[model samples]
Structures are given as structure tokens and as C-alpha cells.
Target chain A: MEYKVQVIVKPLDAIANPEGKAVERALAALSFDRVTKVRAGKVINFTLEADHPEKARSITEEICQKLLVNPVMEYSEIQISQSGN
Target chain B: MDPIIKIVTFPGTNCEYDVLKQLNFLGADAELIWHQESDLGSCSGIVLPGGFAHGDYLRPGAIARFSPIMEQVIKFAESGGPVIGICNGFQVLTECGLLPGALSKNDRMRFICKTVSCVVKTSGSVLTSAAVAGQTLHLPINHGEGNYVCDEETLKYLRENNLAVLTYTEDVNGSVEQIAGISNKAGNVVGLMPHPERATDPLLGSTDGQVLLRSFIEASK
Candidate 1:
């Protein structure tokens, strides 16, 4: 089975998010004052072959643990869905 | 026999030659090792020079950690061989779990390139063994994401174990506790943001980097 996977990676809340803060300041400079707590992260999407949805999720989780995520500073959220043939 | 040092170069790594030149000048036989090579092949020390490894894709050092050569690098470090990761190489060390903490985007979100004063905090590590505590060395830092961050527990461990080897004289990039470099508990592996290779030449404005690199070369022996 083919599954589509998306991983959302971001710095932990305890870690400083300078890019997010810079974006927030830019937004405020543009007079978008209502926005607060702007945090920035990256999304990675890819497709892979797996025997089942659970297997795909596990594989995605493994990938995140091994490479996609730095547990010291970043966290990742993985989303897996069955791909349409 | 003169100690042999291996400088590992990833595809985007541009500092390999600089490091090679500096190491050779310092009297160690240093060679450039490609990222795909599986074996270190009897080298006394390994260095990961600074650059945008894997083009800094995903993140600095993120993709490079998965390269074939890194497995051997990790094993070498585990076996207590001296290893130092400079700049982006430092990022790779943290990403690979060879060192603690992560290098985050600069606090002001700017790529800073300039010389900074770093105080050696411990001479226990392979990188700082030649310097005494509280000795300040001027080294150049060039990076977009050099801010280092780690959780409190890890910070405490680093502090107690004297693993935090070098710290900035001031907050250069918002690194926690002004830390510019650190070593693993064993003190064989070290990672730092500043470019020691760049400071080896007096013409480049400072010879302070020689102190650190010399320490690493000595440790490799």
C-alpha cells in the first residue's frame, strides 16, 4: 500500500523561536497588531510504500526519530493517509 | 609518527580545505575525507568542517547526519577517538546525538559573520585541553543558525560535568549561558560554532584558533 506522510517540525516551546519572533515583529510593523504568539515551523511531505496504514505511521515515526527530529530542540507531528492509486 | 587527522567533507562543505591547510600547517598530516566513505582508516582524529551540509536542507546538519560516513564517525567517537565539529559540523554533531543541544536560528534571525571572544571554560575536553579556564580566544563565527539551546537538565549536566568547554564573552547568538562550544561527557567529542580553522593565520587577524586546533591535534596523538 502507498501512503502519503506529512511531518510538521518545530522548535520546542522551551526553545527560542527567533524566526517566529521575527515574523511576528514584521507582522506588527505592518499593523497586524491582533496577532500574538506567532511560531514558525516547517512541513515535510512525502509518499512511501507500506503494508498497512499503521505500518506507514510507524515508519514515518521512525524516520522522524532517526533524522527528521532533534529531540533536544525540536518536535514533530506526523500525519499519514492512504494514497489514492 | 605525526598524527593523522581526517577532515570529513560533505557535498556542501566548503571549509574542508581551510581546515586541511591549517592542520597541515600545524604539523599534523590532515586529509579530506568524502562523506560517502565508510571507514576512517586509522586516523587519530576526525573533523567536520563548517559549511551548509546537504545545502542545509531540512536543517543544518540534519540531512548530513544520515550520510554513510557519519556511522563511522559516531563509532569513532564512541570508541573515544578525538573528534571536533566546527560550525555546521557542530550542528551535525548535535543532530547525530554525539553532542548535547541544538543550534537554533540566531535570536535576531540574522546570519552573523564576525570575530567573537570566547572564554575557555574547561580544559578537560579534546578541543580546549591546551587552554586554561577563563582564557579568552578570539575566533570568527559565520552562520545563520548558531544559537545553541538545550533543556535545563542537560544544561545542568553540562555544567556539573564541565562539558561546556567554551562560552562567548557576551551573548553573540542567544546561546544558552552564552555557550559557544561543548563536549560530550567523555570529553573526546566536541562541537563549536566558531571557526578555529579561520583564525589560524595571523593575517586573518587572530592566531587564537591555533590554540584550540593544536589542542585537538595533541589529543589525537
Candidate 2:
């Protein structure tokens, strides 16, 4: 089975988010007063081939721990779904 | 024979020549090693020079850390060889777990390019052995993601172990505790955002960088 994996990695809340702050300032300049908090993150999309969705997800989780995310500064969430679903 | 230093160059790396020139001027044999190669070619020391590797895609060093050459670099560092990562090289070091902490985006989201004052916080690492603990050096820094950050526990460990080699005299990028450079526990691997190679000439406004680079060259011998 082919699964589509989407990994979203964001800096920990304790870490500074300058890109997010820049977006917020831009919104404020455009008169969007209600938009208060903005955070920036990275979304990585890839395809995983496995016999089962559970196996694909497990492999992705391992990769996330090893590479896609730095535990010291970022947190990650992985989403997996059947391809073309 | 002069000890050869290998300056590893990724696809997007730009400072390898600068590093090569400086080390050559200091009477060391230095050459660029491509990222795909598994062999280090008899180099005694390794340098990961500055620049946006892999176009700084997926974060600065995230992509470069997976290069085949990195595996060799890691092996060399583990074997107690001297490895220094400057600027984006520092990002690669942290990404590959050679050093502690991550270099986050600058607090103001600006690409800082200027000479900054840094003080040698410790004299134990390969890069700082020629420096006194209280000695200051002026070096050029050019990066957007140079603000080094780590948890309190890691910071405490670095301080207690004398791994924090250099600290900015003033907050240059909002790095934790003003850290400008740090080394691994073994003091064989060191990384910093400032460009010591760019500061080697008096005509360049400072030669303070000689102390650090000289220390590295000597250690590799």
C-alpha cells in the first residue's frame, strides 16, 4: 500500500518564532486587529510504501524521531492516510 | 608533511575557498571535499564552512546533515579528530548531533552581517586553546538563523564541562547566555556562527581570528 505522510514540525512554544511574529506584524499593518497569535512551522509531504497503513505510520514515526524533528527545539505531528484518499 | 585539512563542501556551500585560502596562508594543506564522497582523503582536520547548504531548504542544515559525507564526518569526530563548523556549518553540527542546541532564527528575523565582539569563555577546545579565557576577538557573522538555543539542562552541562568556548560580548543574535561558540565534550568538535576565516587579515579590520584558527591548525598537527 502507498500512504501519503504529512509531517508538521513547529518550534516549541518556548522557543522564539520570529517568522510568525513577522506575519502578525504584517496582518496588523493591514488592519487585521483580531489576529493576535501567529506561529510558523514546516510541513513535509512524502509517500511511504508499506504492506499496511500501520506499518507505514510506524516507519514515519521513527523517521520523525531521527531526522524530521529536533526534539530540543521543535515538536512534530505526523499524519498518514491512504494514497488518493 | 603538513597536516591536510579538508573543507567539506555541500552543493550550496560558498565559503570553502575562503577557508581554504586562510588555512593555506597559515601554511596548512587544505582542500575542498564534496558532500557525496565517503572518503576524507587523508585529512587530519575537517572544516564545514559557512553558506546556505541545499539552498537552506527545509531549514539551514536539515538537508545537508543527511549527506553521505556527514557519516564520515561523524565518524572522524567520534575518533577524536578536530572538526570545526562555522556559520551554516554550525547549523549542520547541531542538526547532526555533533553539538548541542539548535540555531534558531534571529530574534528580529534579520540577516545579520557584521563584525561582532566575542570573548573566549573557555580555553579547552581545539578552536580556543590559543585564546585566554577573558580574551576577546572580533569576527564577522553573516546569518539569519544564528540565535543558538537549548534547554536549561544542556546549557548547564556545557558550562560545567567548559564546553562553551566563546560568548558574544554583547547579544549579537539573542543566543542563550550570549554563546558565540561551543565544543563537544571531548573538545574535538567545535561550532560557531562567526566567520573566523574572514577576520584573519589586519586589512580586514581584525586579525584576532588567527588565535582561533592557529589553535585549530596546531591541534590537527
Candidate 3:
């Protein structure tokens, strides 16, 4: 199966996400949420063409470590689904 | 007195000359050591000059941290030798685990290049002996990944240990606690984001950078 992987690099801005924090507080106040943590992050959307799921994940990891992300302040998560064969 | 300080020059790093010139001006011998070489001369001090090392490809200093000379550099620092890393060199030191925290992209995602005022906080470091707290000095910073980040608890320990060396007088990057520089726990390793060698001359704006080098000179002896 083919997959699409996205990685984002973002700074931990102290005051840059006050709006997000306010919303999070509202969610907890309303008592309709099981949300625990929230952070404003950038999204990098792209398609990855690989042979198999194992190959896809390894490739995604390599790309993240190499070019797709700056490991300093950014963490990456890889999502794999059938995109194309 | 040991004449020459060994300056590590990683591939793609371009600031060795400025460091060499600055040291030479201070009448201290300095030489550019290659990244691919394992030999670190018998010099008592080491300077990791600023520049784009390894094209800054795999993160700012990620790739360069594993370079051959870095192995030698680590050993030098292990022996309690004075080691100073400027700008990109700071990133490398952090990535190599010689220092704590990390320098990420500037808060604005910009490569900021300008002379900004900085205050010396730590007094006994090899890089800040003459610079007392609140001593303002102008230095140029040109890097995209210059914002310093560390956890609050770790930052507290750094402060308690007098490891946080410099802080920007104005917010140039999104560094936590306004930290512009830091030293290792042992206090022998110094890492800073600004280019002090660029400010070593009055013609450039200020000779305030000379004192940092002077401290290294005295401490190495």
C-alpha cells in the first residue's frame, strides 16, 4: 500500500497560541471534551510512492530525519493509507 | 603560553577565517582544522567557528555533529579543555550532546542578520570572564535556526549552575529565557548563537567581542 506522509517544524512560541489556549480552556469548561493537550503546529501534506507499507514507513522516517523536518523543535507523525498502487 | 588554538572547520563551514583573524589580532595563534581529520593539535583551546556546516542539511548541526573532527572535539572537551562554539557551532555542540537544549528555526522563520545588543550573564566561563552581568555588547547574528529552546526545569538548572552565558537585550529570536548562550555542566564547553568574531573590530561597530576571546586566551593558560 502507498502512503502520504507529512512532517512539520514549528517553534514553541510563548504567546503565539493564546487563541488555541483559550479554546482549549473553553472545551474543558464545557465538559464535552476528553482533550488533554493541544499545540498549534504546521501541516506538511505530501504523497509518498513506495512499494509496500514497511518500505513506506522506513522511507517516511528517513525523509523526516533528512529533509522533511527539523528534529530540534518539531516532532513528526507518519500516516499511511492506500493512496495508489 | 600555548600559541595556537585549534579551530574546527567542518565541510561547508565558512567562518574559520574570521575566527582565525580575530585570534591572530589578539596575538594568539589559531589554525583551521579540517572536519575530516582526526588529529587535534596540541593546542589548549578549541573554537568551533560559525557557518553552514554540511550545508546545514540534516537539521542545523545534526550531520556535522557526527563529523570526524567532532570525535576529537568531544575528547578535547572531555579532558576539560576550553571549547567555544559560535553560531552554527552552537547547534553542533548541542546536537552532539556537549551542551543542552536546541536551536530551532527563528520564531518568525527568518534568517535574522544584524548587530544586536547582548548582556553577559555568566561571569566565570572561558568565554565571558571580562563580560559582567548587564554589560552590553553588539554582535551580529545570521542564522535561521538560532532560537534557543529548553525545558523549564532544565533551564532552571542551567541558571543555577551559571551556564546560561548571554541573553539578547532585544528579542531577536524566540529563545527561552532570552538565552543567547550556554555552557556545559562542567563549564568548559561554551555555545553561543551570535557571531562574536564579527564584532571583534571597531571598524565593524564594536571591539567588544575581543573580551570573549581574551577570556578564552586567559582561561586556556
The candidates' DockQ values read: 0.82, 0.81, 0.15
User: Considering just chain B, what TM-score does every model have?
Assistant: 0.98, 0.98, 0.96
- Worst ten-residue run, lDDT, model 1 chain B? B1-10
Error of 3 at B160 (Å): 2.0
For TM-score, the strongest prediction is: 2
What does candidate 2's lDDT look like per residue over B1-221, in tens digits?
Answer: 55589999999999999999999999888889999999987879999999999998877898999999999999999999999999999999999999999999999879899999999988899999988999989999999999999999999999899888999998878899999889999999999999999999999999998999999999888
Over B153-179, each residue of candidate 3 has an lDDT whose tens digit, in order, gives 778889789888889987888888888
What TM-score fits each model? 0.96, 0.96, 0.77
After superposition, the stretches of candidate 1 with alpha carbons farther than 4 Å from their true spots are B1-3
Local distance difference test, candidate 2: 0.92
Candidate number that wins on DockQ, 2 or 3: 2
Higher-lDDT candidate of 2 and 3: 2
The Cα RMSD of model 1 versus the native structure comes to 1.4
